[model samples]
Target: MSTYKKYFAAMALIWAGCAVVIILAYLLLFAPQSRRRLQTENQLKETKRAYRAGLKAGQKDAQDLAREQIQQMQHGLANFVTDAESSANLIFDLSQIANARQLDSFTIKAKDDREKSEMSDYKNIGENHIDVSFTGDFNQFATFLNAMERHQPVIFVDQFKITRPKRQGTANNVNMSLAVFVRKNNES
Candidate 1:
């Protein structure tokens, strides 16, 4: 071969080898790094999407809970009364209940103003306090208490005392302090 042709052939071979080395370096080093960067970006996008979905679900859950609580409060408000006349009517209902149970004697008295003041701190809420005394057999007393519990106005028994006369064949006496809750108009 001619020397000029040989030199040209050697130069072409060297150029081809450099090209292969560059391609291999790119595949081995730069390609993997670019793949990793693409994967990291995809993961970040997925994380952001999941975070947004979770936030929306949490907001919906909180709204549902708030709605449920508001409904309960509305129901409670419906059952509450606001006036003295209604309180007296509830007491009259109690007397009728005692009559139905055939209690020997039933009496009720209102509590003092000092006692009512302590419970009036809650907004638009008031409590009616009464001392009740009755005389009846055990079965009749149980029926009377159950009737009171089932009555329209809610009654709470605060304290109770029962006594049996020393003499046989006498009815037992019961004394109880009761509190009934009522809702009042917001006065200021």
Candidate 2:
């Protein structure tokens, strides 16, 4: 080979080796760094998003929540009642729920006034527990309990119990106590 041709061949071989080294360097180093940087960016974004959501939740958790609850309590307290007519009407309402649920042998009776006179703390909120017993399927009983919980007078379940059915395909016997917290109205 001529000297000039050998020189050209050597230069071409050096260029090819440099290109291989550059490719190896990129595969070994730069690509991994880019992947790590992308991962770090995603993590940073997620952390910032969580921080912003926490800030929004923190704003909601302020004293305004307490004030809102107090307002609700005041609104509920406005419906306090303690008269024979009110008690009778409330009983009728409960019987209506039992009837709607198709419960058998439903019975409800309000506890006497001695339980009411004891009052509940400084709020004067007293709970009058009513004895209730009925025979029904589980579905009907569940719906009855749901209706009682969402009743307009704010009824709460106190004592709840259930007995197994005496025979297969028979209704279960259930006995429950419900409570109503009410302040005495001036008219009473």
Residue-by-residue lDDT tens digits, candidate 2, 1-188: 69999999999999999999999999999999999999999999999999987776578575577679988987766555344336567788999889989899999988875453445553545567788999988898899999987777777787889999878888899999877766545443
Candidate 2 — which residues are off by over 4 angstroms? Answer: 1-73, 79-85, 113-123, 185-188
Q: What's the lDDT for residue 59 in model 1?
A: 94
Note the Cα lDDT for every prediction shown: 0.82, 0.81
Candidate 2 yields a Cα-based lDDT of 0.81
RMSD to native, candidate 2:
11.6
Error of 1 at 7 (Å): 54
Q: Clashes in each model (backbone N, CA, C under 3 Å)?
A: 0, 0
**CA RMSD of all predictions:** 13.8, 11.6
Clashes of 1: 0
List TM-scores for all candidates, in order.
0.59, 0.53
